[model samples]
Target: MYIHHSDVQVVFMFTERFIRYIQFEKRYSPHTVSAYQSDLDQFTGFLNNPQKLSPPPPPVITHPSQITHYHIRNWMVELMNQHIIARSINRKIATLRKYFKFLLQEGVIEINPASKINTPKIPKNLPVIVEDVKLTQMLDDNEVFGTDFKGLRDKLVIEMLFGTGMRLSELMGVKDSDINEYEGTIKVLGKRNKERIIPVNNELKLLIAEYQELKKKQDFFGNNSLTLIVTDKGANAYAKLIYLIVQKYLSYISTQNKRSPHVLRHTFATSLLNRGADLNAIKELLGHANLSATQIYTHNSVERLKSIYKQAHPKA
Candidate 1:
């Protein structure tokens, strides 16, 4: 039974129902749902467009059979030629594959056209990593002990990023209770809301302890305080706020590429791997869903080998 134009709520209702089904019934993680939501929103928006679907289109697509492979292919092409990154294009395709699989199992469609579509081939680019010396200087560059509270907040922010090697989202989501001084670890919620405990360096532990002391004196860590890193106003840190802090500190050193919170993460992974840290341990630390996703760091090791070979070769 196809959803009709007259039933606006039916379309909305089914979308929510299907999403919930995937979340609970199918055991999809929250991170997985976030990605699926982004893809489906775009997909449904395309189908609802007056130019794409015929005039007086139905609000909800009731029948899974109504979707065709042609539509899926067209979406892929649009993402490709329109300059979307191949990796991102592939991710959107994966989202469709999972959604259509659900529709097939539910008997909504006789065939899964999305399954037939090919994923775009993504090229691997060199991972953006910062030099250890530059990162060292950037972390220690916080001499700006201005009189205002914001200066103290900013100094702590940069130090945490370099110390923890956490993603911007992960850092922003951290809460006060997540820090365990006795354990010398911070509980970080990673992609898909997966939780991992990362050990804190002595410097970071001491710094956070000092900050906590200040926070107590100022009465900032009050009940209902949700964020771990806060602004001078004692609110949660946003992604943009993290970006601005990274930009300011990274400017103090000679970095070749753009410096963002993610670069700090890549730097952390590469630095650890270069220092002989186990790949499996690094994978867990980074919270990668698959080992293949973490395998890109191997390329950096290969590049390092080449650099050393060229420098030491007496004949060359």
Candidate 2:
């Protein structure tokens, strides 16, 4: 890839340094680091051929200093021409901004070229939430989930997601030591390695206890596994398996176009907000970095109010 660049060595060297900085100093997750790396690769590919065709291309972008607002604008137009959504384009823009900022800090560039670029505005779509009645019926129906280990585990997985509003990664990371059975609270390791304690009600606590007992009877759990949730073979639960578990059960109860573990998370937040839970409290429980990220749930509350008003008002 460097052979295509005019100042290949400089750009190549600085890009590696930036990757290391984010991985070590910034403590970014692997998934996030991969995204940043992909963005840089895409930009470099664009620079190699602004027209995006094979060989016989224009002059390559060899150094960070060669990038300008005009180049950034052209890249945005190309992405738009390919029908990339505004949200994804905005993310790519953010990646460029961060990369250029890092270059400026390291003295690789005099001015940040991406600093002047504007992010495309994205529409706010309300999160999909499972209705309380449907969720209640599904959880209460033992005939469907059954009394077996897999059945019980699947049921608890759905309940835990809805009950705690925890992310799938957080749920997968839970350990026996993280659950304080006596205090009725579970420690959640959220994004950016931040930890928070979410209180579990008696019902959830009981379900967890039942699952634990069932786990002990099974020979699948080896001595080394400390993860709270495990597969039938006693191996650690993976993201896809958990996703399938949630998807299968939600399919039985919801007619909504989208149904996943995240919908349960949305249900948890919207349920609490509809019942008058404080926005700040929900933010803390969800382990959000800021209140703004938690504010989207308020839109659901407003829509609920509109529905109630339409039903109660007799002006028609």
Assess the local accuracy of residue 83 in candidate 2 as a C-alpha lDDT between 0 and 100.
Answer: 97
Residue pairs in steric clash, candidate 1? 3-62, 31-192
Q: Model 2 segments beyond 4 Å from truth? A: 1-16, 53-58, 216-226
lDDT of 1 by residue, 70-145 (tens): 7777777777768999889889888788777877787766788887888877788878877877667655655644
Name the top lDDT candidate. 2
lDDT of 1 at 134: 67
lDDT of 2 by residue, 16-86 (tens): 89999998998775657888899988887777664443333336556778768877888898899999999
Give the number of the best model, judged by TM-score: 2
* Candidate 1 structure, TM-score to reference: 0.82
